[model samples]
Target: MFIKGVKILFVVLLFYLMTSTSTTPLEAYEETSPARRLHKAHALCTLNKSPPATDDNDNEQIVETFIRCMATKMGLWTDKDGYNAKQVAKFFNKHNYENEVMTIVDYCNHQHQQTNLDLWAYESYRCATEGRIGAWLEEYYMLSLKL
Candidate 1:
């Protein structure tokens, strides 16, 4: 009788261990789901301005929109006084890319000087994604275009 009781207890303990160690479907899905990954990527993508659409699954369109927006700001949004380096610095600081301010400014300045808006926009996207997020964006979201 005592041995049977011990066997039942052992089975219950095993069941408890198995259930406790295993993650539920929802928990497992949340970890590796595309939606979760996209959410993280989107945070960096639209860090400043609003993208074309919040729920838009078209990554290419979103990136193009962002690049165009940046180009416009760099080219057309300047004051009569001229380009605002402080504004650029503040923008990078906002996105936690403070160290990239000088690099981006230099890159965009070169493009702006060349008077090529198209090249400026593409280069801006490349320089912006040059940090830790670049690889992930390139591989998963295709945010980096071959230039």
Candidate 2:
């Protein structure tokens, strides 16, 4: 009888663990990320401030829309595979995805939020003199300014 009880408990524990597992690992990790979206209606804008809305999914336009939508301040929306602040850190630390990260940062900072964007801009400015977000802006405030 005791053995049967132990087996039942173990089965229950295993079931609980299985149920807790998520199908979309990307969605699970970004459930509560501090990102937001920033974009203008009608005319989409890329992180580089280029005119947006191309057929290409990875084109500047789509990226601009995604970043603007998920920016921290706007809190408008987010997607499972969209960019975020973590990606910015990765780009800065590893020089990986530099263009994508910079564009996303500029897209968000320019339209939606400020403070965190500012911090990232500072970091971006110090790291590279000719990268996406920091270097692409027209003036110091536009590029370096966070909010």
Q: Write the per-residue lDDT of candidate 1 for residues 6-90, one digit (tens) a residue.
A: 4333432332333334344324547544433333433443466443555433433444444444334434223222234445455
Instruction: Give the distance in Å from residue 108's predicted Cα in candidate 2 to where it truly belongs.
Output: 9.3
For candidate 2, write residues 37-135 as lDDT tens digits. Answer: 111211232233445436443342333333333232333223332235454444254346656665665454344433444233322222332344343
User: Which 10 consecutive residues of model 1 have the lowest summed lDDT?
Assistant: 138-147
CA displacement after TM-score superposition, residue 95 of candidate 1 (Å): 8.3
Segments of candidate 1 deviating more than 4 angstroms: 1-66, 70-84, 94-100, 111-113, 132-147
Error of 1 at 51 (Å): 16
| Per-candidate alpha-carbon RMSD to the true structure | 21.6, 21.2
- Candidate 1 residue-wise lDDT at 14: 35
State TM-scores per candidate: 0.31, 0.19
| Model 1 lDDT at residue 65 | 47
